[model samples]
Target: MLKELDLARREAEVSSLAQAEQDELAELREWLAAPEGAKDEHRRIAGLRAEVKEWQETYKKEKASWMRAICELTKQRDLQVSRADLFAKQLGQWRDIFQETDLTNLEQEWDPESSFYANEDAERRECQP
Candidate 1:
């Protein structure tokens, strides 16, 4: 009887140890199936990277369009400045010519009753038809 009792006790201890090991294995498997923190952080990082790439592409396209518009406006402004400079030069030439002329002594140069106007009037009336 004593020997039988000792064997039964030993068997029970072994069974308990086996149960503990099985529990630990099941816990480890559950932990592996659902991790603590790293996977979620990795997903978030990947999403952020995609968003950044999209923003960079948008910025590049907008920057290129703005640069093209600036170039076109700059060309138009340069053309306008050149035309204004040409007009200024012509006005200066006309001013110089008019400044050198004597307008106060105009009656001594020509007369209204001269044959020049009489002949010019006659030719103008004839050409009107």
Candidate 2:
């Protein structure tokens, strides 16, 4: 439309009109390519979003793995602490029992010919008869 309008008004300036038409065509081509360039930019934005989503998913997976590992370690540590506490209580009781026992009297009583053993044997014989 512009070319035809300009041609009708500028019959005497053919060369100048031709140059103006070429310049207008170049401007129109650039305008037409704008949407296509925007489409390429949109594609690049979509690709970047996809990459970000992939990285976020990987981070979530790794965080979950680390949480599981920490939970497992905590459970193991608790179990070990409980076992150690139980062992400590049992050892304390054994130590108390050992400290209360008279090792010298126990050894003497263990001898068969000791007077305490003889007295026990006499009591047994009397009970049997």
lDDT of candidate 1 over 75-126, digit per residue (tens)? 9999999999999999999999999998987877777657688889988999
Query: How far off is model 1, as Cα RMSD?
Result: 28.7
Relative to the true structure, candidate 1 reaches a TM of 0.52
lDDT for each of the candidates?
Answer: 0.78, 0.76
- Clashes by residue pair, model 1: none
Per-model TM-score versus the true fold: 0.52, 0.55
Backbone clash pairs for candidate 2 read none
User: Stretches of candidate 1 above 4 Å error?
Assistant: 1-37, 107-129
TM-score of 2: 0.55
Q: Could you list the CA RMSD of all candidates, in the order they appear?
A: 28.7, 25.4
